[model samples]
Target: MQSPQYLRNGEAPQQQQQRLPPHFHSTVSVQKLRRFNTLILVFRFASFCFCLSSSIFMFTNSRGSHFPNWKDFQAFRYVLAANAIVTLYSFAQMGISVWEILTGSTVLPETLQVWFDFGHDQIFAYMLLSANAAGTTIAWTLNGQDTCTASNAFCIQSYLSIAFGFAGFLFLGFCCLLSGFRVVCFIIYGFRFLVL
Candidate 1:
């Protein structure tokens, strides 16, 4: 028989098993956390690839009449520059992530890293979004009534490049979310610590 001492807490063994403490943890297992971090690393790398490809696509196009390359339009230049910056940032972050996964060391304090990543991500996300909007808007405005015109290869290429830029923007959004989650977790833990 179960000891009477177990019931002194005022619950049966089965009942206690079913009821979690009010402050119970909801964290993922360590293995799962590693996998999640690796997954984010892969995703950020893919984002870097997309940004690089988009930059190449836009920069190489010379078919447009008015504008020979991405530099011709301030919006296109912005897109190219923003994507390049994001590409570099993603690469660096990927390295940090890999290092963290392997050795459990971070360049910054855990909370600071989370906040730093979140802030930089928000900034870059905004920049990428704005650049994408500007580039796509200008591309469409240049296209006018023509529906992806066959004659204007530059116009078509511009659209395609902008599409790639949009893809990069999507990946950046994912990075932002991951970093934002880290920041949120840090904030929650800070609050809990204060409470305790």
Candidate 2:
């Protein structure tokens, strides 16, 4: 019978192939991904609600009397347009979020979807923020003038619309951060960074 040969001096035995840890491809845990998906959905829905309400309030600010309406102010029109656009975007995102939640994958190709989410979220968030700022400035100026005194309802509606716009922007900003994180992880770890 022959015995197994031993390693010679200064010679090392071959090592077996080792399996990587579960988290080798992904830094975020499965639980974290689930939470993130849920958060994205919630934020998208919140944005939709706020932006929709903002648009409606701004659009309906007109009274039957001869008081100057939201359309009269360029800033107010911008606010309405921005919120309307954001509302549509948020509604679409909400559908995408629901799709991801039901299926652990994105509707579009993973890379394209991640980039799309990040880009759109950033653009719309900033758009809503700027619109709110301009609307707020106009509202403040109107408040200090006799216009607000004559039609306090218009001033109140304008402020309310702008408030909702800011709230929508805040939620959209959160979505942007989440999407940006996905983008960074993808850049570093590829699509394996998350199950999607």
Candidate 3:
């Protein structure tokens, strides 16, 4: 029952509609999302391990009669404290990731997570870097002093701890990159992750 007026345009409307792909606008792929989330989790866990080790190594090292303990050097104390802070933050962030995976949902708003990641990652990275630099400077100065065998051993341990702190900083850089990518995705695609 085609109307003569509609028939003037050529073929039927149903044929035109069938030519378009159905469900073409859905941008988020569940599997891809899970993979991205998992990558964050893995990176954070590695960062946590490095930070924790850095703190332990620095805190446990004794300066012998040189200064008695780690508290003797402000720089060493800063390194221990900064690493401890970053360790806790990393663990909390990992917990958030795990919760999201288990619930199959975002607890925080999508945009918030992106910015939160960027801010915290930047903050901790800088803190760790600064602490490492300070500690390394102190250790180098100590090594140059021609101290006793005990003090030299303590300086070596301090270097080892700073090394781990540097490793954590590198991992945090990766995390920042991922966060930036997420932000770009949001800007370009309006929203990539599925809600709920």
Tell me, by TM-score, which candidate is best: 2
User: By the TM-score metric, which is better: model 1 or model 2?
Assistant: 2
lDDT (10s digit) by residue, model 2, range 1-196 = 9754546553334321243544452435655676788999999999999999999999999986689799899999999999999999999999998888777678999889999999999999999999999999999899889999999998999999999999999999999988998899888777624552
> Quick one: ranking by TM-score, best first?
2, 3, 1
Pick by lDDT: which candidate is best?
A: 2
For every candidate in turn, the CA RMSD to the true structure comes to 7.7, 5.4, 5.4
Clashing pairs in 3: none
- Regions more than 4 Å wrong, model 1: 1-28, 63-67, 145-151, 190-196
lDDT, each prediction = 0.75, 0.87, 0.80
In TM-score terms, candidate 1 sits at 0.75
Per-residue alpha-carbon lDDT of candidate 3 for residues 1-196, written as tens digits (9 for 90 to 100) = 9673433357566666566463243335666677788998888999999999999999898845645477888999999999999999999999988877666566688778777877889888999999999988888778767542446667778889999998988887788788778778777765634333
lDDT of 3: 0.80
Per lDDT, what order, best first?
2, 3, 1
* Runs in model 2 lying further than 4 Å from the true structure: 1-29, 192-196
Better of 1 and 3 by TM-score: 3
Error of 2 at 91 (Å): 0.6
Model 2 clashing-pair count: 0
Candidate 2, residue 145: how far the Cα is off, in Å: 1.1
